[model samples]
Target chain A: MDIQKVTVAGGGVLGSQIALQSAYKGFDVTIWLRSEGSIERAKPKLERLRGIYKSTLEALKTDPSAWCRGLTDSADVPAEKIDELIARVDAAADSIKLTCSYDEAFGEADLVIEAIAEVLSEKEAFYAEACPHMAERAIVCTNSSTLLPSAIVGYTDRPGKFLALHFANNIWKNNTAEVMGQPATSASAYQAVVAFARAIGMIPLELKKEQPGYLLNSMLVPFLNAAEALLANDVADVETIDKAWMLGTGAPLGPFRILDIVGLSTAYNIVAASPDAANPDTTAGKIAAKLKSYIDAGKTGVNAGEGFYKYR
Target chain B: MDIQKVTVAGGGVLGSQIALQSAYKGFDVTIWLRSEGSIERAKPKLERLRGIYKSTLEALKTDPSAWCRGLTDSADVPAEKIDELIARVDAAADSIKLTCSYDEAFGEADLVIEAIAEVLSEKEAFYAEACPHMAERAIVCTNSSTLLPSAIVGYTDRPGKFLALHFANNIWKNNTAEVMGQPATSASAYQAVVAFARAIGMIPLELKKEQPGYLLNSMLVPFLNAAEALLANDVADVETIDKAWMLGTGAPLGPFRILDIVGLSTAYNIVAASPDAANPDTTAGKIAAKLKSYIDAGKTGVNAGEGFYKYR
Candidate 1:
């Protein structure tokens, strides 16, 4: 179990954070972001994140550079640079080998974590590509919030070794994670994944049964929808609607406030498009549609300075 | 403006707190408990509340006994106490009169507040009984969570004086109130109510139009329903669910936790039976029915030591 080198797929907020944190943990990490153009666009962000990581590590009184030593920006390196990236991943291999790759980067990974797009089809395609190249026992995990674990690995040959490892935002700091078990996910795999999550400073909330959207989102959606309804009903206006939850419930921000931060459009889509919304009362369908109307009208909430309420 | 005496009705939690606070505010207060039986049952509670009120006044650097010198307990006085209650109330007339009555109590009241049961029919019946007896200039307000203002006072002769005056639970401390307006309610009445609520150390979040459940409950029901669903789905145990809101979302307690403290049976009934639950997506119907089963089985949450999860 001397896994060292690791590859991180995707360069979204979650993916990037995973890459930065993996580097911080003293792992030889490679981030396989989409394309050359994306690499160009993401370089500044990656650089800034690295700087932040450096400062964070320094503040914590730890060696900042140790984990990020062989950090390679493998977004769109030439076919030749792929070997260089692979060599860099393997060079520091006396330790654990961890890779963040979609099958293409699989040759060097003793452990692979797929932090790619959340779409089921895209995930399945990458899993298909990575399955043939993965080491026999290389542990695979998805940072999925909703997609069912069994469904994700249903097409994979080694479904027994795969599991859903859900992480909250700010992965480097947050402790809450859900270790979900699929029907095919073996007990050994569950224990190993749980141990790994714990080793990396996570408070793992294990799922006895795999359910889509897991725990948090399953609850969060209905609350968000109700906020939208408050707006639709012309009940208390936006400020009061937002303020009531804060003052009455002591919520950090009211539902509408959280909705704006999460992107009203995204929140609305999730609520309206959720497979669970078949029941009107359970889904907050009217509110979701109302939110969509607001989004469509270019009033996408705080991000655009207007939502349920105007923002400064 | 010389309010030397006051009558506080109901003598329940909200009613008792309001009465105690009114007494501490230097008004000679008479509390109108429902019946001789209720008075007997509430004797110890009133004594305890008096202690709490005294401490609260002392904390504010005020003399409780001096202000509460005229406090009267109308507990066992029977039907004969009504005249004494009215006389005491008239003696305390300082413009704002808080009560939980729907009967002849409003005849002498300058401002009659209905804080009785949350049921629409009960509240409406009380308002009907109060309006005809109310002074021509007297105002009527209901501390309702969901019922429409139009419906509450629609049958009353003086609907123009009726509106919704929502108060947070800790009435003596929380300065927030919501003034909801019915179509028949006059502008002057709305403004006066706002000013009155403000005079009593409340910040009014005024609503232009009245609707069932108003704004706050409209926004809150979804949150409660979401929590119930989470419990039903086994996302997290009750404690963890409670922690997510308190620690994660920074709410005082998660929805179910609040429901427990508030009485799971009470909350379940409100969500399930309220006219507001007529809207879709609440699942209040299902959850409420389930909670009722628990309650019937003597498994009522927190107070009963068992709910979605066990308490010590």
Candidate 2:
């Protein structure tokens, strides 16, 4: 049950990071895409990620505290040693194959991490196609941010082999992998994924029960929603709310600043999914309306240079 | 309306801090207590706070970043200068007088802060009796944690002058004051309170509209609730949940640690106030049940040296 050959089923943001991180950890990684267009987008993303890793490795070579705990005992490690590790990651990157054919992608995958669109039908189709070609021993895991594993577990041919292996945005630094299993999932399958998560440099938080949004988002979203409610209710303006949070909690960034980093549109999508989104009186509806105005104005988030506040 | 004389109508934990801070700011401060027993309890709390201020000043001298922002330019300023400031604080401490007589406490008072019990009846009774004795131009403010300004504004004779001016714990350092006015509160009243907050070294977050729980608690309570829910559902252990939060958000302390600092009983009282406290199905009820078990065991919080975690 040693998961070495990993197949990532999407090459978008979280998917790309997961793929790059897996390769960097010396796993024989393959990225599966629906079309050549996705592969085209993924190429530049991979290159950009490589550049980021190079700079991060360089920073780790100098200051260990630059990125929290920098690559472990980074201070004692020589520049040549860090460069060598960077070269190893590059070598691992070379071994990764981009495939459009499901059979080719799932050929030797010990683990297939489904990172496709969050849409139910889309995930079902991806799993249906993937299940037919996947190895008999290969465990499948969904990289869903919000959707439950039970929703997709039924679509997979082997329900006991399917589970959720969620990862945070920054795979390299904030290396948190939340492993959630459906009721039918085998303990062996869950353990293998947990082991794989650790192998790829992530602290695995194994949930005994299935939870929508898992641990991080379950706690974080409510906090963000509360901040948005204050704005929508007109209790205080954005600056006052942010300043109050910063001054009160001694936190450098407030919820609004975090929303800017998350991209308001993505945050809006999560809120919009709930049944309460339709009611304007509800906090979700108010948040959606505020986000819609920003999204409509082309102020989506930090990437767009503005959201709740200006980035630059 | 130049406010000079200040009468704090309570000798509780927050009231003691408020009176001490006001005196430190050179206000002619008076603490009106219900009984001599209450004054005795407040005396030790004030001494401990003075000790905290001195040690904090010393830390600022050695390490500027020890506690967010240091008091003045402590590095360049000699230890003698810090000693002089401490002596000045001690001198201000002399100005704070304890009184059992409301007439004596409120005499020549330009501002009267009602920091009495959270119970509506007690607050109303105190306000109903103190109104006739209050100065014609004096402002009345409540230091309520959860209750809205609109709820108690009607109890005062001058609704236009009544408001809520809330402060966070540890007034000397984490000096956040939330200024919330009722629907009937005058613009001048709100402005005067905001100015007063600044004069006492507090960063005032003036709310144009009344909000229950205000800014800090509005955001904090939901976070604590989420953590409690995770524990109640048995998704993960306490340490695991806390570790997940800290590692994911880079937050210094998790919700459980914060509960310990707030005192579990205080946190319990907040949850118990909700109608859901009777039901085990809801998060509020679940939190109350968990907290009650600890409370029944006489493990209140940090004050009792035990809560979610035992303190030395």
Candidate 3:
């Protein structure tokens, strides 16, 4: 139950972050990629994260507001201690192991986190392939944002040890890990994941039962949908909608800005999949069309340098 | 037409705020109350606002972050200039006129803001009575959060000059004025209101067309309703839901805290009015019941010193 050797199965955005965050917290972490090409792609992400962490730590030395709760325990870290923390970031960045073999990654891992693609079939195949290689005591968690844990639990060898541990993007700052478990998931396995989440400096939002979109997305998705509805229905323009919410609620970013960061394609897919999108006259249908137009023009999101608004 | 002598009908919370904010910006402001009791009720609210403005300005002198954009033009005010600003607050506080006579309040008014009761009949009655007293050039705006401008435009003397100018609570800080107009509203009137909103230190959110709930409420209501559904459906507790959002988005307050500020009675009424609330098994019905229980126990909101959480 004492999680130490952590293996993140995928070297994607979240996978690399989970590995680096674990290693940064002094855990023996390894990233399990499917091929050598994946490792090559993941290396630059880790290197970039190292620079971000070091510079952020450097900023924290003078500016207390620059303190990222996920990066360090305290905002008031002493000058010498900050240097030690920066050293730890470099050490963590250099020490994390990356490999293509599941047996090598999972055989000794006390905790194995599945952070591969979100497709259900791909996740099922991953669980089936890696089930035999994982240690008997190893607890497996999927960082799936959309899928329910119960749907994939059947593929894993130990249903009792499998659950979902979802993290928001930019885990270093927006550090919230929603730990959700299926009916079959054991109490011990759930508690262990909660403890591990805290140890890595994430606020664990424990869900009592299986909820679609978990807790964060359960609230965020609808809020975003409503904003999109306003835009699609021609009630207001993009800036007007964003400004109203920002000025009224004192929130830093508005829904459209969040959608841009979330990626327009992801938003499009979610909207398109909704039942209301079947009718061309419906608001959801209109929104899907609007998103598709932007996406067709190559304005995917902040990743593409544009979406709702342009970024420099 | 230029807006100079402004009359705010009904000296309620938002009405007093609008009147005070206008007076602070050197406008000739009058608050037309219904009776002597209303004048007495409004006097204390205006007095409290004066204290809030002075203390907030005093705090802004030392703490730059305490600057309320609605209270002043800039955060970088010189030490000596702050004394002048405080003096202006005192002068504005004493100069705001209160009256029960429609002729005295609206005969020479360039702009009349209706911030009376939300009840439709009360608003219609106020408009009918005040129409004869209002100046021929006066532009009238309703500050109703729920009722549309079009709904009450027929009762007014000049439908061409009628529109909605909505303000959020705590006008000194949360300073957004949503300007929405019906189809019959003149372009000149709309632009004048937008200019007046900016002149009073509010970021004007101009709606191109008539939309129920306007801009802020249209977006905020759905977002709050989604959070309420989650709570009603037993997906998560209030703290967990709030923590997940605040940590994930870096928002200052979560949906529940916002609900508490918005007042549970308002939330209950909105939920109860929803068509889905007819079914007891529905989420809206469940939420209505939940909010009613809190309201019945005298835990109305921050005003009542409690809602979802204790205020003081």
Give DockQ for candidates 1 onward, in order. Answer: 0.33, 0.73, 0.68
Docking class of 2: medium
Q: Which candidate is the best by TM-score?
A: 2
What class would a CAPRI assessor give candidate 3's docking?
A: medium
DockQ winner between 1 and 3, please give it: 3
lDDT of 3 by residue, B38-142 (tens): 999999999999999989999988999999989888899987888888899999989999999989999999999999999999998999999999889999999
The TM-scores, one per candidate, come to 0.76, 0.94, 0.93
Model 2 quality (TM-score): 0.94
**Overall lDDT per candidate, in order of appearance:** 0.63, 0.84, 0.91
- Candidate 1 chain A weakest lDDT stretch, 10 residues: A66-75
True contacts kept of each: 0.47, 0.72, 0.72
- Candidate 2, position B34, lDDT: 85
Tens-place lDDT digits, model 1, residues B290-311: 6777788877778788765578
* Interface C-alpha RMSD after superposing true interface residues, each candidate, one decimal: 2.3, 1.3, 1.1
- The sequence of per-residue lDDT tens digits that candidate 3 reaches over residues A1-312 is 799999999988898889889999999999999899999999999998899889999999999999998998879999999999999999999999999998898899999999999899999899989999988999999999888999999999998999999988778888899999999999999999999999998989999888998887777888888888889888889999999888888899999999999899989888989898978799899999888889999999899999999996
- How close to the true structure is residue B183 of candidate 1, measured as C-alpha lDDT? 84
Task: Give per-model CA RMSD.
Answer: 10.0, 2.3, 2.4
